[model samples]
Target: MRAQRVEDTPGGRLPAVADPLRPFESRSAGVATTERVLFGRLTTEDPVQAVVRRIRTAIGLGILTDGQKLPKEADLARQLGVTAFSLREALSALRDAGLIVTRVGKNGGSYVQRPPASDSIAEEQLTGLTATELRDLGDWRAVLVTYAAWLAAQRASAASSDRLASYAEELADADTAAAARRALGRFHVELAAAAQSMRLTRAELALHEEFDWLVQVLLRDETHRRAIVRTMLEVSATVRAGDAAAAWVAGEQLTAYLVTELTRSRLRLIAAGSAGPGPKRRRAGDIVAELRRISKQTVGILEDIADDVAAGVTMPPTSGELNGVVARSVLPRLGRVEDLVHGVGFMAEVGLLPEAEYWMEWWQRASDGTFDRDYSHQLDPSLDDFYEYGSQDYLTRPRATGRPNAMGPYIDHGGVDDYLVTVSLPVAREGTFLGVICIDIRVAGLERALSPWLARADGTCLVLNAESRVLLSNAVRYNVGDVLPQSSDLSLTDVGWFGWVVARAPEEP
Candidate 1:
C-alpha cells in the first residue's frame, strides 16, 4: 500500500494531505516566481548556519506556520543571498533537527514540522547543561529583557503600549497552559519589538528560540503560571506608564523569579545525580582582596585631588570670585587624574561665599569643558542634603566621625538624567571644614573596573550600598539604585568606601 501523506494543522492534528503540487499550482504562478525578502543578507562567516538561524527563527516566531511549504530552493537561495548548495546544507540540517520535513517527486518541497511541546524540548535541553550554564543563561536573559523593556518604555508609542497591555490581558485570560505559554512568549517578543531597534528584536528572538522551552515548562504548574502572568502584567503597566526605570525593574524581577524556579529544578536534578559537577566556585576572600585593591587605588586618586584643592586653590571665606579660580585650577587637575571622573567641584557652606550660594563645578564625559551650577540652588534635595551633612552623617559616619564620604546611584545630577556616585572628602583647615571636595564617577565606569574579576567567576557579582541598593553589577539584570534581596546564596563582603560586593553563583552545588 502507498504511504499515507500527512500534514500538521494548527490544531495539532495530521490530516490526509491532498497533492502538494495542487496547492502550488492553485496559487498564482507569480507566488512561486516571486520571492519575499524578510530580512537582510547573512553577514556571519558561516552562511549555512546563518541560513539555518533565519529559518529556525521564522518557524519559532510563527512567521512560518506548521506544515507551511517553504519557497522553491532556487528562490529561497536567492532571497537569502546564498548559493543553492549552502541552502540545501542548511535545509538538511534543519530536517535532521526535526524543524523541517521533506517529501519526494513532483509534490516534493520542504515544510515546517509541528514543533514538540516547548517545555518537553526545554527539559531535554536542560539535561545536558551544567548548573552554572543554566544560571549564566538566566542572567543573560534577564539583562536582555531588562534592556528591551527599558528601551521600549522610552520609545514605545501609545498604540504600542496599548498592544503590550492587550497581550498581557491575553496571557491572563489564557484557558490552557499551552495557550498561556504562547501568549507569554508573544508578549516578550512584542515588548522587544517596541524598542524600535531591529537588532535588539532579532537578538530577543534568538533568546526566545533558546529559552521558550523553559518558559513552557514553568507554565505547566498552575501557580507558577499565574505568578508569571501577574509579573508580565506589571511590566506592561510600567511600560505603558512610560516609566523606563520601573519597567526595567519589573523585567528583572520576572527574570529573577524564573531563574529561581530553574535553579530549584537544577538542584533537584543534581540530587538525583542526573547532572554532572560544575566549575569550582571562586573564593569570596579572593574577590574581596581584589576589590580592596581597586578601592584603595580609587581613594588615592581622590586624596591627591583633595590635597591640590586645599593647598594651591584657596576658597576665600566671603568671596564667590575665588570659586571660579578654585574650579579653573582644580577641576582641570581632577580631570587629568582619571578619564572616568565625571565631575569635580567644591561645595562651600551656605553664606560662606559672596553670593550666599554654594559653588559647584561639574564636567560630564560628553561635555567639552567644566561648567558651573549652584550646589545649593538647583541640586536635588537628596544630593544637596548629602553634601551638606548627609555624607558625613550617613556614608562616612561609620568609618570615622570625620572622613571622606561616598554617596551614589543618585539621579538628577549635572542637569542630566544619569546615575552617579560621588566621593566627597571634607576639606578643612584649623578645625574649620572649608567645604567638601567632591568627585563624581558614573556607576557604569565602576562596573567596567570590576568586570574583569566578575568574568572570572561562574555567577553574578554586585557592588551594593549598605542599604542593598546596587552600585555596580556584572549582571545587567540589577541596575544602579535597585535594591537586592538578601539570600543565603549571596556572599556579601564590605569593600569599605565602595560598599559591599554581593556574589551569587546561580549554579552553586
Candidate 2:
C-alpha cells in the first residue's frame, strides 16, 4: 500500500491512487454515464433498423429538409448508441434508397437528396399495382385517416387544432399542384399529430411517404385539388369544433372521394394496358353480404335473449342463487341457440354476482343436440377484469347506456382461450339495470363461413378487429391474434364484426 507518484501527461498530471475504492468509483461513474446515454438511444433489437427508421421518419416528416447535411458518421453513431459499422450500414441503405448521398473529402458528409417529382415517383411506386390493389390501398387509407380524425377531434389541444386549421388554409391557398399536394400531405400529418398519438403520427408520415405520388397525381386536376382542399378545411373545422362523429364522417367522405378518383385513374390505366393484364379479381360482395346477414341475425338472437331474461327475472338474484336460476332458465334457451354461438351467459354487475355464478353454457350438446361442448370457464385475470362494470366488455357500454353493443378481438370468456367477439344486450326491466346477456361468436366459425368468399378473393384476406388484431386470416403470413402491420396496399372492408373485417393483400408483390 504505497502511494504512487503522479505521472505527467500531455496536458495534466494524474495521481496514481493506492486506494482500490478510488479507481472503482471513477470506473463506476464512467459506466453510469455511458449507461444513461445508451438508455436514451438503444432499442431492444435491431439497432440498424431503428436508426434507419428514425432517419427515414425525420425525412418523411420534413424534420430533415432536403440537402441538409447529417452529422459526421462517428458523431451520429455515438448519438444513436450504435456501432460505427451499423451506422455506416444504415447510411448505405438510405443512400441506396436515394434518400441521402455521401460525399468525400473536405466539406464532405451525408446530405439528404431531393426527392423525385411526385408524379414520376408515384408512377414508379404504382407501376405494378392492379386495379384491385389500388382500390384496397384506398380503403385502408380511408380507415386510418377517418379514425385518426375522429380521435383528434376527441383529444386535440387548442394549439393542435389551430395548426390543423392553418395547414388546411395553406392547402386551400396553394396555387400550384405541387404546392397544394405538399400542403395536403402536411395537413394530414398535422391532423394525425393533433390526435396526440405518436403511433398515429408516425403512421401518417409513413402513409404519406408511400402515397405521395398518388396525391400528386390527384392534385394535378384543378377540380379534384380544390375539392380536396375544401374537404380538408371541413375536416379541420369539425375537429376544431370537437365533433368527433362529424370529423369521422368528413374524413370518410374525403377518403371516398380520393378513392373514387384513384379507382377511375386505375381503370384508365387498365384500359390502356399500362397496368398490364390484371389478376382475375374475385368480388367478395356476396360473401360480405352473407356475413352481414348472419351477424345481424345473431345479434338479434342475443337481443331477444336479453329481453327474455329481463322479462322473466322480476328481481335480481343473489350471487349464490344466480347459477342455479340460469341453469334452469337461461341454459335451456342457450341450448337451442345456433352452432356458431360458442357460449352464451349472463354477467351480473361485479359484487352483485360471484365470479363462479356467471352463467355460461358448459354443456357438450345444445338443446338442439349439436356437438357444441368445446368451451370452458377458467378464472382468467383478464376475463375477470373484462367483466368489471367499466371494462371494455360489450356489456359495459350497453349496460351504461341502455343500448346494445359489441366488443371483440378479445380472448374467450372467463379465459376459455379462444379468439371471439361478444355481442351483449343490456338486461333491464322498468328502468332498472339487472345485468348483461352476452353471446360469444366463434371467430373460427365465422371464418369458416367466409372461407368460400376468402377463396374467391384474388389475394389473401384477413378479418381484423377494431384494434387491428387479426381475428382470422386465410393468408399464411398472419394468424389469429396477430396484429397487422400498417401498410398502404392492404384493402380493408368493414364487416359487421365489432368494427372488424376483410383486410386483404399486401404491399409487396
Candidate 3:
C-alpha cells in the first residue's frame, strides 16, 4: 500500500480520504477504503527502538550524512507520535552505536558521526572492561574459543579453513598491543564463522564487545598481548591440521598462563600503592599549586583593571549632564571595555540585578574601593528585584567584608582576559572617589594573558552579579544570555554541572 499523510481538520477531526493519490474519486457503498499499513509491515512497536533503527538506517544509507543534523527532539516526537523521553532513548542508542554525537552551545545540536572503523575495537574496550573484569573474561574466552576451534576443525569448508589459516599466519607481524588484539580478535571471529553454524557465529559476534573489553584490561603490553595472540593462533592452526584435542590442550595452557600473570600484576599494583610518593602524587601537587597561582593571577588582573579605571579621573561635567536612563555617551572606550557593558546587559537579560549589584561592588573593591553603583533597575534593565532587595549596606564597608568574595563570579563568568589587577593613588584628592577601581576582566583577554597558567591548570571561572545573572564565563560550553536559575533552596548546591559550588557553600559570595 502507498504511504499517505494523515491530515488534521479544522474541527480537530482526522480527515478520511476516498482516494488519496487520485483525489475527487468517489468511494462505493461496499468498498473498504481504509488502507492503513499493517503493524507487522511497519517498524517496531517499541517507539525507542523504531527511532534508533531509523537513525541507524538513515546513516547507513547516507541519507543522514556525517555532520548532518536531525530535527529537534520535540519536533521529532511530534512527527513520530512518540514522547520526548522515547526520542532521548533512541538518541542514546544511536550515540552508543557511534552513529551520532552531541555538543552544547547556542549553535550546538546533535550531529551525525563518522568515526573510523579502526577505532571501534578501542572504543569498545575503553567503555566496557576493567582490569579484574578482563581476567574473568579471559577464563570464559579460553573455554568457548577452544571449543569453537575444535568444532571448526571437524566442520570447516575448504575456503573457510583457508581464511582461518591465513589470519593465523599474519600474527607474527603484530608488534603492538593494539595490533595483536585486533589480529587475534579477527582470527577468533573467523574461526567461529568457519563452524558454519549461524548460532555459533552470532554468539561469537555478540561476544566481540566482551572480548574487546577483556583484551583491553588483561593484556597490559605488547609482550603480554603478543603471547596470548600467539597461543590463540597456534590453537586454531593446530585444529585446522585436524587435531581437535591439541586445540583443547592449548586452551588450557593459555588459561593457566593468564591466571598466573593476573595474580602477579595485582600484587605489583598493591605494592606500588603501599610505597608512597609516586610520580602521580607529585604531578597532582604540581597541578594544585598551578591552579592556585592561576586563581591569584586572574584575581590580580581584575583588580588592576579596576585600579586603572579608578586612577583615570572621570571628566568633570563641563555642563549639566543630560538626565536620561538610556545614555549613549557612557558607551565603553575600547572594544574590550564594551565587555563591562555587555556584562551589565547579560545580567539584565537574565533578571539578575542583585547579583549585578554585587559584581559592581566587587569591581569597585578590586579597583581600590571607589566607583559609582547605578542602583536603579531601570538603568540596568537586567535587575529583577529592585523593590524586594535594597542597597543599604552597599559599598559602605571601610575594609573588605571578606564575605562576598569575588572568587565565585570570577569562576563562573570566567573567560580569557579574566584577571584580578588593581591600581592605586597615594592620596584621595579632588573629585577622585578613592583613586582605586576594579572590573571583571574579559574572558578572552584573560585566557590569552594567562596562557602559561591555563596550560598548567584545568578549572572554570564565571562572573555573576548579586541578582544571579551570569555576566561572563570561562566555562567553554556555557552560552551568553542564558538566564541561569538560582540554586534550589532544598539542595545545598545546584544540581547542574558546577552547580555544586552553590550548594556546597550556600553562604558563598
lDDT of each: 0.62, 0.62, 0.42
* 320-356: candidate 1 lDDT, tens digit per residue: 4555556655655644545446666666544455555
Residue runs of model 3 more than 4 Å from their true location after superposition: 1-135, 169-171, 174-176, 217-220, 255-263, 266-509
The better-scoring model by TM-score among 2 and 3 is 2
Model 3: per-residue Cα lDDT over 1-509, one tens digit each: 33222222232212244322121253211111111210112234798876775555334323244676555666556656777898899899889988889888874667789554454454444333322334456666666677777777777655555555454455446554444444455555566656555445445544554554344444447577667666766666666677778767775676556544543343333334334543444334432243344445433443444334434333331111211111221223223342221131111112222233322222111233333334433334355543221222212221234111232223221222232211111112253333122234333333233233223323333333334544333332222233456642423223121121221112234
Q: Where does candidate 1 stray beyond 4 Å?
A: 1-38, 104-107, 173-179, 273-509
Error of 3 at 167 (Å): 2.9
Listed per candidate, the RMSD to the true structure in angstroms reads 15.2, 18.3, 20.6
lDDT of 2 at 360: 38
List the lowest-lDDT window of 10 residues for candidate 2.
19-28
Scored against the true structure, residue 197 in model 2 reaches a CA lDDT of 61
lDDT by residue for model 2 over 8-72, one digit each (tens)?
A: 22211222233111112222221222222222355537888777776775565444557766766
- Give the lDDT ranking, best first: 2, 1, 3
Q: Of the candidates shown, which would achieve the greatest TM-score relative to the real structure?
A: 1
Better of 1 and 3 by lDDT: 1
Best by lDDT: 2
lDDT of 1 at 140: 79
Shift of residue 283 alpha carbon in model 1, Å: 27
